[model samples]
Target: MIRNKYVLYFFRIIVGGVFIWAGVLKIIDPLGFAQSIANYRLFPAWMAFFLALVIPWIELICGVLLILGLFPRTSALVLSLFLFAFIVLIWISILRGLDIDCGCFGSFSRRVDYTLILVDGILFGMSTILFLSSVRKKV
Candidate 1:
């Protein structure tokens, strides 16, 4: 991971912007997001609904925090973990022969595919860099 402050800031902006956009979309239509989550068939309906309520808020907050450079490491860590989980889930859905949207960008989601994995992986990498850079600053 690159530890350069400038590069980290770039990543912060990119990743934060992505999450902010995603969160805003989901926030606009909670039921739609819930339905999207349920499409994955991984969670019970109630759980999906509840998660739709909470996940977008978390994404928005963390994205804002990352952009503002406030609690950046924690924010990056949270986003990174989310990215990892998303990657795994995407892979699982693909392997299981389920053609579904990722439910990542609310109404704008694309079909589950290798490209989704690449995008999530790239975001994961960026989040990791931002997190490690923050850690290096503290130490």
Candidate 2:
């Protein structure tokens, strides 16, 4: 149990830091973020614009809460869901042969590829574990 706690703490810090940095970068340039989302061609222009406005804030809030161990279960669950959605989007883009920046980490993103899929997959796994652990502890 102690070892599991340590591992969870490590993953929490890394994942929280990553999301916080990504949110901050996107918040710095909402227009660019919107454009990046639009590039995915997954949503309408207005929907993209709204998502650009709200998503970063959500990421920032959840990331901070996760790192601080406040509402960890909820934060981890939300972050995990977001990561899952991103993985799906990236998969679609790859399958469609749309070679484009993932727009995952703001401007510091890489092209949509299998590597990104793997990274998100790992993140999702960590988030899931965190959420489940929190729930079990509460019970």
Candidate 3:
């Protein structure tokens, strides 16, 4: 049990770090991020612009909170939800044969594909585990 806890914490830190870095990068280049979001052609221009502003902040805050072990359950829940959304969006992009950068990590992003889906899946799994563990601990 103790070993499992340590492993969970490690996963939390890694996942948190990735999100924080990715979010901060996107925040620094909101316009670029907005362009990336628009590439999916899933939202109106204004909606994509607004999301570009807000979503990165959400990711940054939740990610930092997760790393600091503050509001772990809430943070994990938010992160998991974001990951699930990303998974769906990425899948759609793949099905549509849109070969574009995921814009997940700002300028450092890669082309969206099954591999990106796998990465998001791992992050989602980690976030889910953290959320469940935090909830269990609270109870």
Error of 2 at 55 (Å): 0.3
Please give the distance, in angstroms, between residue 29's alpha carbon in candidate 2 and its true position after superposition: 1.0
Candidate 3 lDDT over 2-40, as tens digits, reads: 228888899789889989999999999999999999999
Q: Clashing residue pairs in candidate 3, if any?
A: none
How well does candidate 3 score on lDDT at residue 52?
98
Per TM-score, the best of the predicted structures is 1
Candidate 1 achieves a global lDDT of: 0.93
Mind giving the per-residue lDDT tens digits that candidate 1 earns over 61-135?
999999999998899999999999999999999999998888899889899999999999999999998988899
What Cα-based lDDT does every candidate model obtain?
0.93, 0.91, 0.93
TM-score of 2: 0.96
Displacement of residue 102 (Cα, Å) in model 3 is 0.5
Q: List, residue by residue over 1-139, the lDDT tens digit for candidate 2.
A: 3238889999899889889999999999888889889999989999999999999999999999999999999999999999999999999999999989988778798899999999999998888888888988988
| Comparing 2 and 3 on lDDT, the stronger one | 3
- Give model 3's TM-score versus the native structure: 0.96
Instruction: For each of the candidates, give the backbone clash count.
Output: 0, 0, 0
